[model samples]
Target chain A: MTYCVGIEVDEGLVFAADTRTNASLDDVRVYRKLHVFEYPGQAVFAVMSAGNLATTQLALARIQRDVDDAAPRNLRTFRHLFEVAEYIGQVLVSSQVDTAGRPEFEGISTQATLILGGQVAGERPGMYMVYPLGNAIASSPETPYLQVGESKYGKPILDRIIRADTRLEDAARTALVSLDSTIRSNLSVGMPIDLALIRRDDLRITERMRLDADTPLYSDIHANWSRKLTEAVHTLPRFPWELPQD
Target chain B: MTYCVGIEVDEGLVFAADTRTNASLDDVRVYRKLHVFEYPGQAVFAVMSAGNLATTQLALARIQRDVDDAAPRNLRTFRHLFEVAEYIGQVLVSSQVDTAGRPEFEGISTQATLILGGQVAGERPGMYMVYPLGNAIASSPETPYLQVGESKYGKPILDRIIRADTRLEDAARTALVSLDSTIRSNLSVGMPIDLALIRRDDLRITERMRLDADTPLYSDIHANWSRKLTEAVHTLPRFPWELPQD
Candidate 1:
């Protein structure tokens, strides 16, 4: 299981993903779920995935192969962000189709879902959730973010904090908080978190970091959010029965 | 869809449920989902449900009818809280089987899941989640709460705030926060919450409320929580890059 989110605010875009991958309860390992494809000042795309790891790795390799082979249609040649999402979707579906045809593998789900966020030289910064069926939906002003896998536990905070005009850094912080909430509630989504930021119009990933369980920054954010949330609950108005009679 | 939660703390239990019911996005209505069976000083039980409303209504009516007709095994005759839960699970399962056997209802689901929290005079106060399969599980010290229907969005707060030692009113407040989060995130769950409290050994509901959108206490709790959550986020430590460089 994995939890990855992409936010497209007016000022920039933020992407975060968990690193834990488990084939079974006893077979847990750390694997990078965030795939970065960058051309520095020209364009940058961050792909975060959840589902069958083999399918995602195959899809990622296909993407890199296409770029290395300089295929007619590859990430580098795409003029828009959605085009990149479409190409990745096709790759992801094709990768799953490989194992899906075998009768022995019938019970396993070789599906993968992805969040693609980036900006091209001329296109605006945006986010898209590419479904396992090779379809995609872009984030709009009203819904400025997209999430995949183990998403619900972390969604309330995003619904409360994220807006189109939210500060780029603040959106990054919110994404971290969202991930933290999910990690604490679910064992499948664990640390070292992959975080990336893209300042609108920069056409590049301005900064990136990996936050582990002991990362001071991530630890502080986690602890502070917990304390503050408890404090917030404590400050809510008391029930009528709890109040002293006038 | 609905959102109902039953929490058990050292002091007592808290039950809260949303009133919204939707057949479709357009065919939405408000219906009570919390049912209380109190024998005052003898025993008390709160049954909250989510799923096919017909199934729940049928199961609820059966309980009352059994009491009215003096059935051999009725809620009033139960010796322990688990016995009551087991009885409810059977009733709920039987209600679903009614439509399950009909060919015309094959495409629709008549299943219901329930949270039963109460106490028999001689038994310890406890809570149980009765499954559609006619099985039930009791809340333990590690997990002092049970939630049914649209539960994920509201779970983070419960995990953060509730414990075996948490104050009863604080647990009630946490339940409200959980419901508020679910209501905001899901259109299927909505307003006019039904809240009830059962103090340990009290053998009756100490306080009950139906909080509509305009209810002052509910409104205040909602508004203040939002404000305090925003403030809490603002005070979190800034990103290293967000700080001033020396």
Candidate 2:
């Protein structure tokens, strides 16, 4: 289980994801789920994945190989952001097809889902949710975000905070808060968190970093958000009995 | 497709549940999920359910019939709250057994889960989560609450707010906040909400009310929570670049 979110605000795009992976409780491993492909002035793409780690690694490896070989249909060959999303969606499906239903892998779900976002040199930055089945949906003005894996626990924060006009830093903080909510509510999701920011029209990745539980900035965000949320709950209109008498 | 929470605080117990049921998206209906059984001066029990409606109704009917007939092991006969929870768990399993695996209902799950809480004559107030498998677990100091169905989206608030010593009304409000979060995040869970409060040693439910979206207190809670939560998000510490320069 994983939790990853991608937000496409007017300022740019924000991507955040947890870094815990486990085949079982005793077989836990820390693996980076966010992969960035920076083409400097050409294009920059950030892909965050959830589900079978092997499958996601397989898909990522294939994409990297495609770029290395300059395949007829490669990540770098795409002219539009959605085309890149479509190409990655295909890669995800093929990765699962390679192992799912094999006699030895019968019970395991090889399926993987991804949030792919970036901007090409001539196009505007956008984001997409790429399904394990190879279909994709782009984020729009009405819905400025996309998420994959263990999404529900973290969604309310995103629903409340992210907007098309939200500042890039605000959107990034919102994404981190969303990820933190999920990590607290679910055991499968844990830190360190990987975050990437792509500034609109930069045609390059602007910021990419990993945030651990002890990281000063992330720790501040976590502690401050919890305190503020608890204060918010306490500040709610009290029940008739709890109110002070006039 | 339901969300119900049973909380045990020092003041007493709080049980809250949503009122939406559906066979599918297009076949939605509203049905009460919280049921109270009060034995004034003796014991008071509240049972909230999620999962197969028919199975829950069947189990409920059986419990009622057992009490009506004054059977050897009726709800009134239980000496401990756990025993009552156990009795209900068995009833839930029997309810499913009565119709599950039948030819016509091939893919449908007849399983249902329940949260039962109350105080017996001489024992302390307590709560239990009755599983579909007929096993039960009691709420403990570490976790003074139990939830069933679409529980994740609503869980963060419960985790942050509810405690063994929390005031009963505060617990009740927290449950509502939790439910509201779920309703916003999940289509399977919705309003109007049912809330029941049992004051310690009352030997009966102290108060019971159904809250719709338009109900005054509920409406206030909904509006205030949204505004306060957004405020909380904005109050988070700003990033370096977001800070005002000297």
Find the candidate with the highest DockQ and give its number: 1
Q: Pick the lDDT winner.
A: 1
Evaluate residue A47 in candidate 2 and report its C-alpha lDDT on the 0 to 100 scale: 93
lDDT tens string, model 1, A42-150? Answer: 7899999999998889999999999999999998898888888889889988888656568998879988998999999988888899999999999999899999999
Deviating ranges (above 4 Å) for candidate 2? A68-77, A93-104, A240-246, B99-104, B240-246
Writing each residue's lDDT as its tens digit, candidate 2 over A204-235 gives 88888888888877898777775677677666
RMSD of 1: 2.7
Fnat values, one per model, are 0.63, 0.49
- On residues B1-246, what C-alpha lDDT tens digit does candidate 1 reach at each position? 899999999999999999999999999999999999999888999999999999999999999999999999998998988889989998988898556567888878888999999999998899999999989999999999999999899998888778788889888888988998999999999998999999999999989999887888788866667567666777777777888999
TM-score for each candidate, following the candidate numbering: 0.91, 0.91
Query: To one decimal place, how large is model 1's interface RMSD in Å?
Result: 1.4
| Tens digit per residue, CA lDDT, model 2, B74-110 | 9899899888988898888889855555889778788
Predicted complex 2: CAPRI docking category = medium
Model 2 TM-score relative to the real fold? 0.91
Q: Candidate 1 regions off by >4 Å?
A: A93-105, B70-72, B98-107, B221-224
Isolated chain A TM-score, each model: 0.94, 0.93
